[model samples]
Target: MTETPLAPPSARRSRSRGRSQSPRSNEPGQNLHLRVPYITRNIPTYDLLSEEALDRIEATAERILAEIGIEVRDDPEAVRLYREAGASVSDVSANAWRVKFEPGMVREILKTAPAEFTQCARNSANNVVIGGKASVFAPSYGSPFIMDIDGTRRYGTIADFENLVKLGQSSPWLHHSGGTICEPTDVPVNKRHLDMVYAHMRYSDRGFLGSITAPERAADSIEMCRILFGSGFVDNNCVIMGNFNTTSPLVLDGVTTQGIRTYAEAGQASIHLPFLLGGAVSPLTMAGSVAQCLAESMSSCALTQLVRPGAPTVLAGFLSSMSLRTGSPTFGTPEPALGSLVMGQLARRLQLPLRCAGNFSTSKMPDGQAMQQSMMSMMSAIQGGANYILHSAGFLDGLLSMSYEKFVMDTDMCGALHAYMKGMEVDEDALGFDALAQFGPGEHLFSTDHTLRHYETAYWDSALNDDQPWETWSEQGGIDAAQRANTRWKKILAEYEAPHMDEGIDEALKDYIARKKASMPDAWY
Candidate 1:
């Protein structure tokens, strides 16, 4: 191949200025960039597998479902539905049955599901599209502990949960308020879901996930959404979602299947996720793990369609590596990232939206290790084409603890991703012919008309990064990124403002929570 020669600087300077430049009247501040409700990727998704390889994976998943079968424990209705839908069901125990499907049955059932749908928020303007090219970032869910800003690791409380919700609301990068940002150990296990759902409604107007611990809790979450949004709106449109995990090694417990039915029957959305740990619950190889994940997720997702056709469903895969010597779970590894990329391809083939990797880390602190691991996992999700990303921030201690500083730092990275996913624009102005014409060789183009026109929005500015000279940084107490993140989160919480809610709705939610709490005794596990 022959290389093209570059144009001479003198010739470039002779080119005409394509268009005149105009200065923006109100220039945005460094930190005051635009906030998007959700990201629509302009760049193409990274497909790691070819068509033949994807077919082989799908065929393997089919074979697994047909031969191994999944145990539907304690859910007779689910087993009955499977039997009626042409799947073979046999009694394994008093309340458990083994269900097996043919090669194409699950896929045929999943065809009833919509490829994409809208999840409305209390503020209609903040509503989000949950499929196709859209990508929504939500805070982490189900952390029982917290790494406090004071550098102490302790159990999370209701106060901590509420504070995390406030921080999510304040962040411009996050679109969804997220569900169960942390477990409130201070409250009763049965009643904490009520409080968590209420906090998301009160503090943020963005859409969020709901409780899925039990069928009743799932119903309660839907009822609360009915109160916030009108009953008619709640029934017709998806406003809330439930993230349900299937028991690994091809087992779908009754409670999980029941919860899936509850959300689907109510016309709500549900994410069918299988947490596959390599060399433990699943095979050591990535390809085998992918097949197993596909089989489990497809079975649960098909159940949603059995309950109600056209229900919104997302196929999710959470693949993790493990320490072979100690048998502990690992996160943010390369094997799982490759698995995520393949999952994206499978989801597209199934014509369902995908929810894949996120800012995952096993590090206990929000340090270099945490950030490095997070980038590896997070980039997989972004490039692999996940639509709704849970655990986008505040994940630490392998998801056992939520770190405030990590939350802020991750949000700052999410801000950068907003620009990264936008790709680049190529137009008459972007070519910079005008700038070259305005300036000659050996002269700076900083003061050119084109520079001023696009300067403010040209690049993404980091809120936690330090680019000052070493002496300046040292004079300022030599603060590091974690320390700076700590200060940023505290400042955000101090100035936090809750979104508006109607007086009647607020009272109704409060009354509902009180009644529910009084109905049950405290149970701490």
Candidate 2:
């Protein structure tokens, strides 16, 4: 068998160009670094529940949908669509309707959604495929406050948002440029989405998410994509995605349902997620919460198909376990991680791409607690076979804050995951029979030819970890991982160069933003 590198073939062909000292330690910027467009899992998904158990959970979801029903608030169009699609609809109030589906109605309606599709990036090489055995890593989303390098927590500005986008673009491990890396509190509430979308367009060429706070903002995001990518291309292909959340305990609010329809009608992709907090918005029991999540997400995703058949949609689950005594939210716990695993199984059963758990933590700082918690949550996403993994880095304070130091630290972990998910290949080179023949019982293989040929690319090298002896560590100020991550992020930002864009396209995009912003006066609320 031929000897091959562990990374995807696409990764081996790429190289770091004009990069400063890499944030990763040990490896220089000029080294033979591997970069995958997205993770194609070679290993099998870990199925924790039996088929019978999964069937039971799915049945429970159907029961919830048929009996209890989901209320559509302030969206008559959504209510009418549900009614046309064979669901029972009744008036809950003048502005709300109770829409209930038969046991199999939702499953049939979801048949039009594609299982997998490509989200194109400005640079074609960075295009990522969602669904099947592929997985994409992206940064944390929707953080209003940031934990600064000096440990001060404050509101995020547009500068901070741009910097985060730059950091994501610079990392070889992250596939998609995430949405709402943090809220630009300094910008007006009505107009900040334009700036956020522009930052993703100018600073990064990777596929990214769009705004979903309102339907018009969602339309604005799609319009900007048309300027960057041609109109025909935008209409026919998926260039951008919107991440929308459902109000939990069986409710699809107007803003979210309308947002889903907006992206679907435009032929773009959307992730329908139910952010369920156990004991609060959902059932206290894990199984009950999982069933509720499936019901809520499935109904919301079906709306996308209703708007336009064969539109791309991703099923997402954000399950959190809350403290029973104080009713506070918890993250990176084992229960929710288990919930994520189960959700993966359910998504596969439905033949849809899944977005699951991430590097979640409640720790205020980038300490041992943070890493430990992140590993527990992130591993579930990896082992469970999720397609798009959001919050892949920099999540802290129960997701109330995005830590700058934690962001780089989490990227380093993502680098390791790139290797971990590659699994292993067994071949002629891997057998190493020639080395065994040359070495005696008491001899070592250190100087063998096989060792020399493969040593450089043998293992995943970490950049932030210090493995030196105590004396060397002490001489170097005994810096910890967080301190090292702090230095690295600053270094990365200082050297970051925005990917080049065409002059004409840039001007058109700026003109669009200017006209849009000028139309609306600054509304800070």
Candidate 3:
């Protein structure tokens, strides 16, 4: 990439640019910053996994599949495919089918899979390729409100799809445009998943997160990505799908697992997310809750590895506590914060990527509480060294809704946290011995030529935080973080521009969705 020229010292001095003048009375101090590593130390590292344990887990999973078999149901096409692959099947009912697994088949599937994947952004420089030393971030799962052009908020709709793609295009931090933005209610139910895939490809020049309604639909989604980026591109550390709901021992479903197998066979990385509600689904104690989550996630990971040995998979454990009184999932609770730290440690032990939730808010609007919770949670995940952090933005009330203000706040917070994780740089220029000499002790560095030369290199937090005094804050209407976030949201939306796409690619995506819709069975619109 070409580098931009730096501004001259004199020019920088005249600009009067530095940290925001707003008083940071509410800013957490140095002690708060120290908490990053403190929480990180609580979890165990990846080195804990013994070679023998990994082997045992893999072997045990294969035996479980071969001996016990997986229950497949409500999808005849999936049943037929498994049977054709040499699995035993029983037609339990007109709509249900069960498949008996063979250990060898699982191994065969794993061999062809890729170990890493990459999600290319519109700007190639910002691209996030997963499966190696680095980690990537995705927008939070399942948000309901979508930001519109008029600066108004409404329920997520097809239009929100366009806006989200545009936003993803603008954000270098977000690696992929995820599914489940706004349900394309106007589209047929079976075809809605396909429509989302098509929209992501055409509207944003980034890799996609796959989650179609069924196995066959997942195949179509993979194929679309393949056609856009080329065959095996989807397998090359680009595509990822969450195998959720199916991995829960208490609520194992057929359709989600079918999607997992389909993606696994296609060589895409399949991350098994075992979501447990601490007070409800599992034990209330943090350790016991985490252990339960570990068992569930590890079981799924073991199964995926057995189904496809050495297949690129992640251990995803989402343990949120449920509010016993309100019957709501409370993401802002302290238990989830602790759980993510532990889960990150477990992933490290397994020598696999760990996917955890972050930037989650329970408040209906972006507020002080929202900012505090989101930042704290995200810092925990990053400090714990999670490989892929999901649900990084636009979520609230435990993923049931999204707020535009909160999304923008998250963007700013993510930017700052990412800066924090970069730690300190130690180049000769950064040492600033010459600059130190230029501005001796007892002298102000602000007016020195050396300070002027390098001032822009310093990190500056965005508007979500202000460093003004109470007097200044009160004069400015005493606006809290949420009001400021809303202002930022409006500003970003005002400057929003659509990304450039390949000529005719948009038309082709629409045509493909139309053809798929036309081909679906009458029962499925």
Whole-model lDDT, candidate 1? 0.87
Residue-wise C-alpha lDDT for candidate 1, range 1-525, written one tens digit per residue: 011122222112222222211111111375344457789999889999999999999999999999999999988999989999999988899999999999999999999888888887776556788888989999998898989558689899999999999888877788899999999999988889999999998888778999999999999999998877767767778889999999999999989999999999999999999999998899989999999999999999999989898999999999999989899888888999999999999998998999999999999989999999999999999999999999999898899999999999998899889999988999999898998889878888899999999887889888789999999999999999999988888888887766656677789899999999999899886
Encode model 3's per-residue lDDT on 427-465: one tens digit a residue: 887787777688688876787676787665465445467
- The TM-scores, one per candidate, come to 0.94, 0.95, 0.75
Number of the top-ranking candidate, with lDDT as the measure: 2
The lDDT of model 3 is 0.59
Which parts of model 3 have CA positions greater than 4 angstroms off? 1-116, 120-124, 145-154, 232-243, 306-310, 427-433, 469-478, 521-525
Residue 115 shift from truth in candidate 2, angstroms: 1.0
Model 1: what TM-score?
Answer: 0.94
**TM accuracy, model 3:** 0.75
lDDT of 2: 0.88
Distance (Å) between predicted and true CA of 372, model 2? 0.8
Give the Cα error of residue 425 in candidate 1, in Å.
Answer: 0.4
Instruction: Tell me, by TM-score, which candidate is best.
Output: 2
